[model samples]
Target: MDSLSQPFTFSQRAQKLTGSAIREILKVTARPEIISFAGGLPTPAGFPVEEIHRAFDKVLSEQGRVALQYATTEGYLPLRQWLADQMTAEGDVVSPDEVLLVNGSQQALDMLGKLFIDEGSKVLVESPTYLGALQAFSLYEPSYTSIPTDEQGMLPEYVSSPEAAGARMLYALPNFQNPTGLRLALERRQELVERCAAARIPIIEDDPYGELRYAGERLPSLLSLGRKAGATVVRLGTFSKVLAPGLRLGYIVAPRAIIDKLVQVKQATDLHTSTLTQMAVYEVVRTGFLDKHLPTVRDLYQKQCGYMLDAMQQHFPASAKWTHPEGGMFIWVTLPEHIDATVLLQKAIDKLVAFVPGEPFYAGADVKRNTLRLSFATVPEEKIREGIAILGKLISEA
Candidate 1:
């Protein structure tokens, strides 16, 4: 018999998840000359290395062995308290007891999947949703249904429709959504809160890029709205966008009952997020550095977005339709109907430019092949212009 056919076998859940296609494609675009818009990564210049170093030194000096020791499954108290306070400022009625510190918002999705999704649970997603979340939830074998979306974001009419009656959960990124960079309108937010409340379906509001807004008035978070409507909403947030991704610190704010279940699930997953990293984040937040740092990040990304937008206007074919986001990292581009972005990837790669194809973002095989996502967050201003020009040339020739 073959070694692979031994008695021992991987869990059914592990067998279900196919690894992220974007991550695999990114591996091919790692060359120094490749101008990539395939990732949701933040610029290296925005990371607070000095502040993190200072916090690390203080954590070691003051907390010593405690910083490296095993911590509670609920996470560090001060970190939880700080997160609660931050959410409170955003108008969310969050208590420390109702918050769970996760490794990343990504891990929170996994925990939610473990806690809620059964083998055949129905989950609703925005069309062209975040691929990473799709990958995270796929392990549970949930049936995904993609709902139609517009510039104002996911429409509320679909959630309670007869077709979506069996959906256990709906996932959305209301502000500065990934791939599309579209924000949910304030009116739609209220509509969704009411509809989901009446239907008794929970909403997972993921807002990793909300704080990276560069323009327009800041809108209230879905959690804040959900609280007012008495709806069940689990809000996931992260420091990866405004702070640093390496810290791997994120949080989920939900009902105490849900938090308790998720905490148990988290305990089985990784025991807890890093105590040292959590302490560093706690210290950094306590010192009020984040308030000062956020504006700088917004300013840098705003200029980059503008550069890319200008280049797109100059280079892209007139038939190509693209979104001009007010804030956040991406621009969603739709090519002529006959084009397939995945097929075009090899040609773009040959020109040292790469973007994620939009097909994988959809929940099913019926995807718009002409669409692609461009990220302006990681590339420099000059590179954004150059890359868009190159991509435009490829589009024109195609």
Candidate 2:
């Protein structure tokens, strides 16, 4: 038999893996004419190009040999210390020893799955959560328990249920959640942490967009609250949103014991994230560059989000409802119950606009097909208006 045609044995996990729904849509929307709200991409205009160039220059020039050499799997120390200090400042007292840098929050998610999940392990998650996280954790073949979630976030009362009580872990994206762009209510944050802690369930708090708030006061993170109540909360942070995604830098802050095991798992995976990249990132952020740069990014996103919401209000049907987020790149639209977003997406694509249908974001059978997510992060104000108008027309027709 020809090697290409031969049937090769594959692992059960490999056999079960499916491509990311957003990434597949990105392929169709790759056409220049398509106005895509399908991806979680940050605007390229927000990246600090000159600063990144300067940081790379400084690192390579100042320590060329060391920058190129292999380093410990724990990652660059100064970067770890900086992460620890930032967490401490955020009210979660952390030590450098508790930090482990990974390729991105995506990798951290995968490593967490490897560390904690076994086949049939019950993992709890929001009804509609980050699809990337779903993709990462799904590989472990764990059975997911979809917690009841809403605009204010997951219902804490559900944590007392038998499914949640036996869950091996609970995953959340509390700040400007990807699909819904909803923040967990402040009171629910503490109660959710306390409930899960009492059950001895580890909470995986993935916070990639925590700093992108455009309105309202910033709320305390689950990590901070969990620590106060003696709960096990592991936080995942990334510079992808604030800096640049191309750098592929993210970190995990957990209990020392968890960090120690994740370090071992990562060693067997990639040995370490790129040393040169870590050093360059440290060089850029060490000077408090994000503090200055992020304000401009926020202003631009707020304007773009406004344009989208305004256009939606003018063009969408009266029955359609959508989230009004204080921050983050997405606005989740909920159409009438009879409309299937997947079917609607094909029509939107024909009109040169694209969005992610909300079904795949759910972990269980109660998937809602009337929902879709629109991202305004990379779209210009004019394009956002144009795209929302097109989507609104299609949805109204549907």
Maximum-TM-score candidate: 2
Give per-residue lDDT, candidate 1, residue 71. 93
Shift of residue 124 alpha carbon in model 1, Å: 0.8
Kindly list the per-residue Cα lDDT of model 1 for residues 194-227, writing each as its tens digit: 9999988899999999988888999988889988
lDDT of 2 by residue, 141-188 (tens): 899999988889889888889877689999999999998999999999
lDDT of 2 at 237: 95
Segments of candidate 2 deviating more than 4 angstroms: 1-7
TM-score for each model: 0.97, 0.98
Pairs of residues clashing in candidate 1? none
- Superposed on all Cα atoms, the candidates' RMSDs to the truth, in angstroms, are 1.4, 1.3
Cα lDDT listed for each candidate: 0.91, 0.93
Task: After the best TM-score superposition of candidate 1, give how far the Cα of residue 34 lies from its true spot, in angstroms.
Answer: 1.1
**What is the lDDT for 1 in model 1?**
75
